[model samples]
Target: MASTTAFIDVPESPDRIWQLIGGFGSLPDWLPYIPESELSEGGRVRRLTNQDGGVIVERLQAFDHTARSYSYAIEQAPFPVTGYLSTLSVHPVPGQTAAARVEWSGSFTPVGVSDADAEELFHGIYTDGLAALLKTAQGWRG
Candidate 1:
């Protein structure tokens, strides 16, 4: 399995950030690449439609409101990945007052793709997604 991780520091409370990130069907609200998302299975699953007509079905595996973290597994995706799982978490920046940290991490095995390509793909997604999340979170405070 290959893993990728991305982290961003923001001037917001951890609880505030978690409220945005923990929304299972809020991808399109912040992610520019995701044009639409449909929630099913009583909001436990989300079907994300990409701008390029690609689709990914993800299921919420675990969520902890108190911990400010959530984990999801990709049931179907456009890429050749297996056992794809991702976790998004918000943490307080110790001694930073209201500052917080957001983390995006995923692990998956490439079915028929090169490890390097898979790594690059995951990294790019996390990098862009986290940047947009930070932007949205900042706007929430304004």
Candidate 2:
């Protein structure tokens, strides 16, 4: 399995960052490719309006507030892939740092793609996606 990790530093508290990333349904606001996303746990699901004007679904595998981390997988990711496990985490930097950085890492098995190509695709997806999201998210003061 190949994996990619990307991080974004936001000028906000961990709580604020968590409030955003934790709300899986709001991912489309920053994550470009995913125009819409939803999170379901227990019996409720929060849906986000997708970038495609449609919708994307997600299932929360695990969420731990106190630990500042969560894991999820796309129900219908619009990609040539399967078994995608995505995880995000937030935490305070060193001392007196009022900023929070969001980092994510995940990997999946290629469906009709070669391992080398899949690896390269995912690498670009994760890094570029994270950078863009970080920029957009930081600009969002609301």
lDDT of 1: 0.89
In model 1, what lDDT does residue 24 have?
87
Best by lDDT: 1
Judged by whole-model lDDT over C-alpha atoms, candidate 2 comes out at 0.71
Model 1 per-residue lDDT tens digits across residues 5-86: 9999989888877777779898887888998999999999999999999989999999988888889999988887999999
Judged by TM-score, which candidate is best? 1
Over all chains combined, what TM-score does candidate 1 have?
0.93
Model 2: per-residue Cα lDDT over 27-93, one tens digit each: 6666777775555565235454555676546677788988788887766756667887878888786
Q: Model 2, poorest ten-residue lDDT window?
A: 42-51
Task: Show where candidate 1 strays beyond 4 Å.
Answer: none
Give lDDT: candidate 2, residue 39.
52
Predictions: Cα RMSD each = 1.3, 3.0
Clashing pairs in model 2, backbone N/Cα/C closer than 3 A: 35-50, 35-51, 36-50
